[model samples]
Target: MKNLLDILSNPHKRMPLDTLMKCEVVLEKLDFKRSEGLPPSGAQGKEQIFNPLLEVVNKCLQSPLANHTLKRTFGSTLHALNGPEIKNLPPPAKIAKVEEPPMEIPDVLQGEIARLDSRFKVSLDTMQTLGSEGSISLFAELQSARLPCVPPLQVFVPRGYPAAPPAASVARAAHSKPDHFLKLLNKAMDHKCARLPKNCSVGQLLDAWEMSVRQACAPNATTANYAPVPALGI
Candidate 1:
């Protein structure tokens, strides 16, 4: 036992196979030296904690039939007779759970945006340069460009009646024949007949329809002279 303890206390004894083989050797040597009888069953008692081999010791001490089984033949021969049963050993104490510290998360979006901007090879200077080029012209050239100060506009607000809807007058004109529609069309095209493009079919059709109605009927256009529109400015 003293030799086994000395060998186990060495720092170099690390491997499981080495420890198991050494323990087997110790048991075998102890058995050869002692030659004790096998232990009986129900041998549980106090001394099994420090030297657990005592539990095996108690078993070898208690077995009745001396026919020499492994535990009876070998184990009784190994260690001392005063050892206790292994199953009677006390359980290890419960350990407390440890609480971990909180971790801080990094801003993933900011990192991704910065990476994208670098990969695209873009700078703020290029955006400002584009904005300056598209600005509108604020001043005209120093030439007498004849801007129309007075356009030919006649806005007459008569005494009291409201103007009839253009829709009603158009409805009446729509009932006319295709030939009458053509004469009014020819008159509207008198000056612009040569100037118009050959592909201006839609514009030509609209002018012809407008001329077809000689006078557009206005039920609400009439105004009494009593309620007059006062002139504001020329």
Candidate 2:
């Protein structure tokens, strides 16, 4: 036991394989001797008897220079001494959640956005950016002529504005024939923009869009046969 204590104290010194085996045998004998006269009680009594050895073994187990076989032998003895009571392990660390930063609107377009909001009751839904390109999606309440109910208009402003016209579509629930209304609006906007001079303002394009929506949802409206134009790009 003195030799084992000396060996455990100096963990940097390697023990021979035969000496390690002998130490394991000594631990087995000590466990048996301690348990021989004890009543079939809990591990509290056994822990008291083995506490001194347990501390030495635990310290040796944490040493980087300790022999793997010696560590294993000490670990087994620890289990025998404490039984199931030593199985309590520390809980795993929790990972924190990361949040994305809010999108910032360009200073150049803020005035146009403010004007549209005041006139058409526009509210931004989402704004996203990738590299130099970005898009802004918004809901606008438009009370067009002959329209049954005020439909929430969904407007998509693409990366390039003023040069590239923004596309508009009505919500599906708003119009009885949503697809037809969208088709007419798209065709009318394309025709109107083609006739207008180059580099029109964002407000001009939106006004054209609003006019197209009014024409599409007019009481005597008819679905015009026109080739489809692509929606605004993000």
Candidate 3:
């Protein structure tokens, strides 16, 4: 305490790293004990949490404090720590940060889209990005029999695929059914599908939806289409 006081009291004085570390160990033990003695909940938080911490701090203050810049800081710190907010105990739950897994192209899914383009009229293209995270655009002629209307779909497949579904969307808003498509897409490609008939690739999901969309949007589709409105002469 004297060493800490001496160092902080003098603007030119700085505590050695080792000495600070030693003090930290002692202070941490005192703090932990003080916290343990506090109310499990808010047993009148001020008396339970703040008062105990304040008392420990006061004992340190009783030692002669130099009238330096650090003196005002010390007083403020004690008051702030023991102020009104101290009564309520901090919640026990520790928030854990979930880091997204690095983007990986599964061997089964990798280069699979290329093989797909070779078989069907659909083409897969990569768009320019400002990041290392990559995306793909899939499309085909709407007149094609294999895929009557393969609207261009773009999806970001950064690290944390499968566990974190790809960020997906279509080129044309009028051609997209985002909510339905994304839900089905996630279900199809979810790597964590614990049931049988295993999860598939993003490309496959896109392809399946393309076929579904084409069928649903066929000129003869029983699902009534919204009538086109005439544009006014400009």
Candidate 4:
């Protein structure tokens, strides 16, 4: 026992594999002998707390079985033995959660953002840059038209865009779709390059679907609205 205590006290003493096994056996035998005297499974008093009990605790902690159920039982016994005196150990500190940094907007894409904000009156509130190459989301709401709006639609614009038309679609359901919002996405898309003047923006293709939604849902849109009928004599 003195050798074991000396070895535990000296950091330089590396116990051999066989000696470590012997130490575990000695601790188990010692615990089995003293467990009968501890608190009788519930009661605590002056008789229960003693130096010999704490010596068993240090032994149990050093044993190879420290992570097992037997070690857990020993831990409970140790806690009872120490009682209010356990305040010597400080409570553990909590770790705060780390959040991802804000998304970045590119210098080249700033022009596109400006065009949408100034001309269409859409702003960054409706858009998000995907990555460094100016890939972005188009806020699919009809800001000028007072209509039931769908969720924000993500427009995937590859590094080289407007050479080909951009694609748009709805986002994942927030568990399910938002109130009054339909999954009216993944619908067919087209362009009016022939009718419109040339050389505006290559990224203009990204806004084509947004324009179509605004035109179709506007209160005075010709297709979805009717002129007031002539009143009959009352």
Candidate closest to the true structure, highest TM-score: 2
Candidate 1 C-alpha lDDT tens digits along 1-234: 433343334424333444545666766655432333444334534322325354444454466742344443335334445475467667888898865433221243224224542212211212222223221111111111222111111111111112210100111234555453333323332323333343332223223233222211122322231233221211
Report the number of clashing residue pairs per model: 14, 0, 3, 0
Off by over 4 Å in 3: 1-109, 117-127, 133-143, 146-150, 173-200, 219-234
lDDT of 3 by residue, 126-188 (tens): 344323464433443234555434345555444544544444444555756666444333333
Candidate number of the best lDDT: 2
Better of 1 and 2 by lDDT: 2
Q: Please provide, for model 2 over 1-234, each residue's C-alpha lDDT reduced to its tens digit, 9 standing for 90 to 100.
A: 555766776656555566766877877766544544565557566456555665676666567855885655466555655685646678988888765556565565678877664456677774434332456676777554455344566766665665565665655563366566566766776666565555555566567667777777776766554455544332
Quick one: ranking by TM-score, best first?
A: 2, 4, 3, 1
Please give the range of 10 consecutive residues that has the lowest summed lDDT in model 1. 160-169
Tell me the TM-score of each prediction against the true structure: 0.14, 0.47, 0.30, 0.32
Total residue pair clashes for candidate 4: 0
Whole-model lDDT values for every prediction: 0.31, 0.62, 0.47, 0.46
Q: Deviation in angstroms for 92 in model 1? A: 55
Model 2 bad stretches (over 4 Å) = 1-87, 126-134, 144-150, 160-165, 174-176, 179-186, 196-198, 214-234
RMSD of each: 27.4, 12.2, 25.2, 18.6
The regions of model 4 sitting more than 4 angstroms off are 1-87, 117-119, 123-136, 142-153, 158-166, 170-188, 191-202, 210-234
